[model samples]
Target chain A: MSRTKLDLWVGFFVVIGMGALLFLALKVGNLGGSNFTDTYVVMARFDNIGGLKVRAPVKSAGVVVGRVTNIGFDTSGYRAEVTFALDTRYQFPRDTIATILTSGLLGEQYLGLDPGGEAEMLKGGEVVQITQSAVVLEKLIGQFMFDKAAEAPAN
Target chain B: MNGLLNVVRLLGAMVTEAIWRTGFGARFFILLLRHSGQSLTRVHLTIRELYFSGVLSLLIIVVSGLFVGMVLAMQGYETLQRYGSGDALGVLVALSLTRELGPVVAGLLFASRAGLAVTAEIGLMKTTEQLDAMDMMAVNPIARVVAPRFWGGVISMPLLAALFSAMGVFGGWLIGVVLIGVDEGAFWSQMQAAVDFRFDIMNGVVKSVVFGAAVSLIAVFEGYDCTPTAEGLSRAITRTVVTSALAILALDFVLTSLMFRGQS
Candidate 1:
């Protein structure tokens, strides 16, 4: 092949190779847990979403069993409505509480479901009445700064 | 006080003259609109340029992305391991690559490699009267010369950015799984759990597209407007690189602000 032809082939393969690698990365990076036979939706209400994006994981007893599928605001309640899909097999009682929790000091927020031992199991579309909203770090920092400023002596 | 006042007056007069004679602000806006139209027209030429800029640069980008990913994963793993949270390596790599490293590094690389070449080529064309020759033939030089490259760069940059992010993630996965002994399944699941398409990848891709347009337009503008002299060509090339690089950074800041504007 001519030099220009060779250059063209090389360029073509480079793009192809890069594209293949990208495909692989996306595939491998997006591997979710094994598919479950039964799943149900759980709803929670929060005062503030607090940087909680959709698809954030929902965990129960530190095990990820679901994910936040959608988030919206309820006009009547004046609160953010977060809906999460959970595996049906992992049954929670009607009295179970859901709280938004962060993994670490600087980590993504996830829904944490605390299962309560009760005879009745929570059904799909049932709202988790006890909900703890997200604790925003910036808000905490701002409050700290405000408190310090208020405590300072007047000049 | 009098001296300062005179200095201020002189500065105001210079600004007024510069704005009027050079038509600085209006010229730039008109140039932007015209170039945008030109860019839209030269689709085929832009594709060819993309073949060069996006495809040809993949090797270096992949190699560099791989090592950067590996290094990031190793460091993150070591740090997280102390807290027994080594499983979070995938999340770390994915978030970092998508948000920051992917676009910025790929943009810098593209600017350094193809950006300078593009400026120099156009500068040479101006210095050698090639652009003038096109003009003599009644060809619109801006449409012919500058538009294709500007559009091409715009098209190519996002592809390269995506390539960079992908390779970097792969590199991170390799280190996390193969080297660090993290389970491949867990590593991937962690990534999936952490990253979302819109927040992570799309953000970088958008930034890349904007950076591409900025770099190419600035470089081509400096080159095409170069004075017909060897010294002028050199100066133009230098200015093109410096100005394009600065524009890339400045635009990135502005774009970031606009993109993340109501979100905390």
Candidate 2:
């Protein structure tokens, strides 16, 4: 009896450990375990992705509603194309602005959606027309320096 | 002058002898590895040892994880509040636990609680000639005894680490959201936004597994090599804890670099 009880407890311990591991993997790590919901793919094009990885969150007004499913570069167009696996529950207008954005200073880059004032909802196999590429600090700094230099000669 | 010269000579000989003994321990470890397949055959013993090492150590892992998490949330809130970003408390607590605190702290506790026990148990058996008696009975002590415990430690370390992180995250939630009045939604959502399943949590699991293997190796090696005396047994147990702690910490650094260096 005692041996059986001890074995039961050990089994219970292993179950709890595995449960915790699964929770961490799914909830905390923001991976699987919520894939039952059907999703729609929305494509967007950008000039720069700026360190965005596949599986980055797709947030709408600070609420995560989907994930980045794939990223590919349009070599001929010199643009980056991104595919989003959006939850079917939330529908965006056809002219929604899909912007590649960083959350915090030195943090991850994600896709932030801003709904536009359009009556027609986005359909499957359609592309989001408006896209704002990732902001490169170096480019902004270079532009600012060039502007200042251009003004210095005049002043 | 001659006496002082003799003292220096004695120190040099002691260092060389210590080095030689360590080499012997390394050889013993290789032999143990060669015979570790016996652990699979001794499944009953492995489960029994796992009960003692892993299940028995769960309480400490959970309690310590809770306290560490609470402290992390409290500290994180204070710091983030200074920057007016207290809503990011979940991200802070989760990142710290999953990356640094969870595996490292749980590993240290496992070393003290289970690793030391394994060492003392084995060392005492050696001192009392039980291991030799087993040998006389035509049983290989390393295969029959040590391998099960070694495998037990290796398996338990990662599980304990995961439990610690989970409990710690809950503790942080309790303190940050319930007691401290942080927005509960923001806490979890921020964490979900910031932490990556592959990057942060997976690397933490890998860290725990490596620490487990290294610490278990030390525990078995020290117990197997102790001088057969009461004092020697005690010293071996102490060395097991100390060496496991040091090895876990050092391995954490090397593993962290190798895991995260590519992302940056």
lDDT per prediction? 0.76, 0.88
Model 2, which residues run further than 4 Å from truth? A1-3, A33-134, A137-155, B1-11, B262-264
> What does the lDDT read for residue B75 in candidate 1?
92
Q: What TM-scores does chain A show, candidate by candidate in order?
A: 0.74, 0.82
DockQ of each: 0.16, 0.43
True contacts kept of each: 0.12, 0.68
Indicate which candidate wins on DockQ.
Answer: 2
User: What would the per-residue lDDT of candidate 2 be over residues B160-249, giving only the tens digit for each residue?
Assistant: 999999999999999999999999999998898678787789899999998988888888888888999988988999889889999998
Whole-model lDDT for model 2 versus the true structure? 0.88
Give residue A87's error in model 1 in angstroms. Answer: 13
Please list all clashing residue pairs in model 2, or write none if there are none.
Answer: none
